[model samples]
Target: MVTAVTDHTDHADHPGDDEGREGSGHARVEDDFVTDRKDVRKKDFDMKDFIKRDTGKKDAGKKDAGKVGVRSESRMFGLVRVEIDDYPEKPASGDDTDGTDGIGNKGRADGAAGADAADAADSGVSWDDGLIARRVSATAEGQARPVKEAVVDSRPPVVTPLAYDGSLRSRLDALRELVGLSRTRLDSRTLAEAGQVLDEATARRRLSGQHTVVAIAGATGSGKSQLFNALAGVAISETGVRRPTTAAPIACSWSDGAASLIDRLGIPGRLRRRPLQSAEAEAQLRGLVLVDLPDHDSAAVQHREQVDRILALVDAVIWVVDPEKYADAVLHERYLRPMAGHAEVTFVVLNQIDRLPGEAADQVLDDLRRLLDEDGIALGEYGEPGATVLSLSALTGDGVPELREVLGHFVAERGAAVRRISADVDAAAARLWPVYANRRQAGLTEEARDEFADRLADAVGATAAGEAAERAWRRNANRACGTPWLRLWRWYQDRREPPTGRLSVRTHADEEATARQRVEQAVRTVAEQAAGGLPTPWAQAVREAAVRGSQGLCEALDELAVRAGAPVGRPPRPGWWPVAVLAQAAMTILQAIGGLWLLGQVVGFMSPNLGVPVLLMVIGIVGGPGVDWACRLAARGPARRYGLEAERRLREAASGCGRARVLDPLASELLRYREVREQYLRVTGVGV
Candidate 1:
């Protein structure tokens, strides 16, 4: 049997209680006990093995020893006596045990202990007590147990890192610093001062973290000064009846930062750099740096130069155009198209919109936006989609606030200048890379060169010279090698030598003309090929120059011949070797003829029968071979000299052709590309 007992430890503790119980050899088990106050007579116990026999009567006299206190002692009387503190003595219930009283009691006590263990487990204190009791009971009963499995978690979590580059304002600051460095290198006073103004503008932009520098760029009578005054909230810039009012840049700032920005712009103190008067004006401006640049279409060279220089360094440009000249080709072609990459940093303002009737204003704005879009600029974010069309009379102040607000928001965005400059430089670099880079050979092939040389040789009658030289060699051989009799016979044979039946004077002239044509055609072809792919104007110029050079070369060659006193008919068909061979042939023939005549005169009167004519014949034959060898040896010097002269002429022609056709065109194209590139770099804030 088992019973549960709840022990309130503070009330239950007794001093020296364990010492008092020690002599009985009773082992104390640390355990919690629970009991019900109403169940004083009977103990409801929990046990592993026990049988309950029901009894009819309630045993009021029985008490739960666990509710009070129970003490167990092993006595020499061979019995374990259990004592109860404040126990109400009563008879045990009949269900407490079987008829064997002591065994039943012992089982009830063990069941009560088990119940206490259960109570302790329910209270979340000691599972060990219950577990050990179960083990003991199991061992006694010879039962087996099952094994348990362990648990694990398998999934893991993921992590990421965060980092970013500088913000728009900081990047603008960096650009300003770069511009400052560029400014210090300028030599011209006006340009340097302009550079200083640009620096000041950049500094303001950096400090305020705003896109602060604004420029009014436009043609004469474009109301750029008026726009500037409207933006400045004051008529600081002179407006006109004058043809071109803003001769130099006029700058205005909201704060002290404006002075630095103006100074960096490199504009002289003649231009105003006024601070805003009121807090509201200051608040409205926050970080604005307005500049009035000179007219782009002005005839004055200085005015144009000023506009160009300021445009290079300004943060954002407001291109002002009057309704009358908004679509001018000069404005679009010269300025807009060339600066296509700066579309992001540019704002096209169709000023004097007030002059247009109400209905016409909207239409004009639409047209303007369309034009700007065609030039690759996206509008809006500065105001309405076509809000770039501000119908304001700087004279009337209508819509001026709207323009100011747009400018303010643009400054707040802080991206206009940076994006503009970056894109400009990138575009310029892309365009120029191919131009500056080494060009691949596409003009002349080696086979073509050889063909040209062959043509030139033919034109110059090299083959005809070769043939004539061969003929001369034969004549020289006969003269130099023959005996006197043979010489006489050779002279007779020469007189009978066949005429050139097909090779008439006309044919020779035709050949010479064909050779000249061939050489000229070959050189012209090479020059044309080299000049291919060049721009039309440059290409035409080069071609004209090449023609002139060719004409000059012909004249030069003519002059060289005249100076040398060489006959002007054509280059000699039979060259030096041929002439030498002919001379040798004549000498050989004369000797042979003399020897034969003398031999015939002395034949009968000679004592020693010397074969003078035969000896002369042998000498003639040997002399022919020696003469032929000597002619061959002598031909080398003249051939090399002529070849060298021909080479020099060829080189000069080639170089002149290249200069006129290739180098000139290439240089012009490259220079144009570079100028455009530098302008783009300056606008976009790129390093050299």
Candidate 2:
């Protein structure tokens, strides 16, 4: 039996909420529940007439129960729910009482019923029929199958790994930027090594991307040339025991495409040879450029140098050793230990293991493993990726196929070139980390800058200039507003030395020398403050920048101080000064008139009574002194303001000079150091 339910929601409660009835609104609710309330149509499906029932394996005397299956489908109209329950049992006879097969038309016989069942399986409701058929089939078999439910996944997608060439190119770009930014601040030799690494990486990438260059290197009498010949399947490199047989490097190519790569290794064209043609063996080793390098411990200096040069350029290295010299100190200490980080591209081959007897070969291999572990080389055992350590006798061909199979897979991966370049970049950046990276984020503080400016101001005598300005104002005020006889007496005294001459900014030889010393000390103090907690190279750069900037600093300060403090012509007089001068003139004239009248009285040329003249003389004497004192008192406030303004201008000029000469250059050097450090971090992939 099939049951169908269609839900019809009423919209009468929310009449104004028509937003849910639009196209965009319907899309918004698609992820949610089906809430459409208009134009919904319902139809029911009779699943019994179309689905097949299995009748072979029913239990004895047990009531049959229909399988339960629920399906919900979403449409534009509304949600439709379907369920199956209480399936009818099959009849005992082959032909039904109604003369029809359960899955076809009403009156069809066996052959026609088969055709009709095929037609019904192809109908529009086939998905429903298929699901019901599986349920009934499970029921007939008397098995309880767990119902499958939909699972909602909420996890975000995984981030893709970076591509090899892209990431390497980005690191190279960052390293270039780091070198450019660290020009005058870092060690020249370290930067040169970094540049060389970048150059080598670029040149390697320009060659064949399909090929892998594997170099076989070992000490004298290690049979590396024999292993090289075994892998090449030809006697390409001569192998005899004359202490050091292979005196130079030789290249063997499995394919002809590695000419450019071999040329880059500085190998002559005559030493390059193709392996013997065995199609199956050669096809597995295609695109392989195997290099036979000279003995690393040869008595000849050029042979050792040749080994070093070729080892530096190869994409991968196979260190071949005999059973006796597998733990040689020169090989372990100079090559294996130093290239420990390049373990992924390294292979340690214990050659001539056929020479050992019984379990002695196994014991020698175990001891070699111990020595490799001591040299910090990780072994690629138990499916972990590291250096590949194996035993083989190149002369007897005992384990050469295993080495050949490993090399075949290694060459086919075509990742050795990229890995070697990445390891090289990592090693170079690690070496430069001490010069580029520091724990503290050092900078110049505002207090230090302010104190530096204050020191410069003091060195130039700004405070003394301000005091002298105030005193000059008071003296000029006295000259303009004092009584005429007092003024004449002051002018006679001032004629010996002018006040303008005293206001000139003149430094004697000793004072100038002292000012220079003070400027140097202030510059040094600020440089030290800025350089604190920085790396040695950067700290030295900061100090050098400050010293270079302070070359003519003392002279600049002297010029600015003279310009700021020099008095222009005479001091400016206020409008009130003229009024005070007139008052003083009136008082002086009164004194003169009174003295003339008293003189007339004494000479008997005028009236004898002189009371008015005596009164006039007394008023003039008291009034003149009182007016002079009043003018002097009024000049104090403006004189103070003028002095402060002079001091302010001088202070500003001195501070500005100091900032330009010392502070700005130091800040720029610090900024350069910061930029270079950031680039270094990018190259190293630190904090990525």
Candidate 3:
């Protein structure tokens, strides 16, 4: 339901204020009320439509929440309220104003009144008649009328949307983290790249805002100071006879904006922020923080350290390498190779070109370009073919103007140093991610494992164990349950009884030969699988590693078996049944002696009734011991001999796989990790 109420306080100013026209004026008021109510209803309808439209198109062009575009709106009011639709809402309380109210006089008035009322309520003010009378009087006098001054809230929007840059920043951040992790795990190039990343990140952060930091990097006696002087248009840095000069960093700046840039660099105000004599002396070079770093090949440890530290934090780098030392291994290995990715921000200067013969200058420049290419540096103008390599003699001021112009243009572009570092870090990280990933290995099929297991079981004398158990059970049963009348019945029962632990013995020859063959086959299959799909060099390495591992396993197993005192050779089959018959005869004679003694004892001299039973017991006990001793003696010789033979066969099998001691896989993996790490570090400008 809609309700309309007109304020009567302004009745005096109405057209029909006279008493005679009260009826018409009242009708007019009702009509105006209806029109206002219709307008409100229309606004409500529009709001609903807006909600539906927004819901329908929600996913049409959704971007990352963090990267919303920043927009600004200017309001006429002193208090400018920035409404951010995407901003998260805060809970409403008596002290805090809820911001969702529709924009109109009523909403504003109610909000303000609510706040004041809440304040009054907290102050223990009573809502009595006296207060009402005072309010009425104040209203009559226009003192209590709501103030309608337009508020201009200049606050920036809560949700400052960033431009949609295709998640480049996030990708870069991930890459940086990866590089950092690689630095911890590996060494060599990867580690160097990681250090470079850190250096760039630091430099970028340092050079952000209005600060300007310029670094001069070059080899010894390369006219760096001369170039520094040319750039500064003054003999600020020592040069000429004092070769390899500028052992320490010398910072130069113009009077204007000099203090600010120096301060940003954390250079103390005490360090002379010297002002140029001419008012327009630093006009072209305003905001330039020129730093003359030590020569790259200088022997001073501190000098090198300073060069490294400043290079990391500088806004721009001027690489001044002379034609002679440009191709030096120390320069390329120590710096160029590692900093190839920073080509965009790097300026390669071929200093002291005046020393070269006129005809040789062009050749040298070409050689420098070729060297840069070999170093993997992208050269030339933006979107052009190669890195920008300029030939200049700092001593002669030749090409200095062109170098200065390039520097000026570069500074004018004012790229984000932090962003660039972030990019480098991201790139380095992307390169190293594969190493940490869980590489999938080709797995053995279930059928293969089962086949191997079956082969192993057969080779280990499974059938022999079964036969031995059956024979042992039969022998024990026959000895325990035998009678003269039931001897044939007992034999039948023995044949029917399941074998226990007596069968044909597993001669060492059989066990060792079978085990050796099975193990060899298993090792060969494993080695083949490991070597498969690898490149030639890697395949050979894998094969060699596998062979070594297998051989070691074989030796270990053989050693363990030998220690267990297993038989090592073939068991003997006696050529004579006479030996067994002789042994039985000896047992019979011992039984007769025992029987005579027992008879003498029983018949007032020996025990007559127990003689035969005593004799049987003696024979049975003696016979079992003799057979057990004979079997052990027969098994010992063959077991020892064959065990060594099995070991030798396994070793031969391992040898067939490949060279058994070429390289340790674990150590090789670690070395590869180090190499990759060093490369990564070099790419990112991270030092070891």
Clashes of each: 47, 0, 70
Q: Using TM-score as the measure, name the better of candidate 2 and candidate 3.
A: 2
Candidate of highest lDDT: 2
Put down candidate 1 lDDT per residue, 449-529, tens digits, no spaces: 556445544445444444444444444444443335556776798789867767787886786567457646756775576
Better of 1 and 2 by TM-score: 2
Ranking by TM-score: 2, 3, 1
Once model 3 is optimally superposed onto the true structure by TM-score, how far is the C-alpha of residue 173 displaced, in angstroms?
4.4
Specify the highest-TM-score model's number.
Answer: 2
| TM-score of every candidate relative to the true structure | 0.38, 0.65, 0.43
Q: How close is candidate 1 to the true structure, as a TM-score?
A: 0.38
Instruction: List where candidate 1 sits over 4 angstroms from the true fold.
Output: 1-212, 216-249, 255-271, 275-287, 292-315, 319-342, 349-364, 374-442, 465-491, 495-522, 536-688
Tens digits of per-residue lDDT for model 3, 1-688 = 1111222111111221111122111111111111222343354334235334544544541332122211222211111111112222122223322222211111222244433343233323332211110011101121222222222232322221112132444444444554554454445675576556655554444333443567778888888878886776544556756545665676666423334344444443222223222233345555566777787788888778877777766666788888788888888877876777677677889987888886788898888888888998888755673346798988888999888777666655555354345546655665555453223433234554445434433444333443443344334333322222245666688899866653434555565776778766765665565444433433455566656665655444455433432234322223333454455445556666766667676677743567465766577557645644564454444444444444444333333322233224523533444454444444444533
Encode model 2's per-residue lDDT on 76-183: one tens digit a residue.
Answer: 223322222222333233232233221121232324334333323322122211111111101111232322222333232232221367778888899988888887
Where's the lowest-lDDT run of ten residues in candidate 3? 130-139
TM-score, cand. 2 vs. native: 0.65
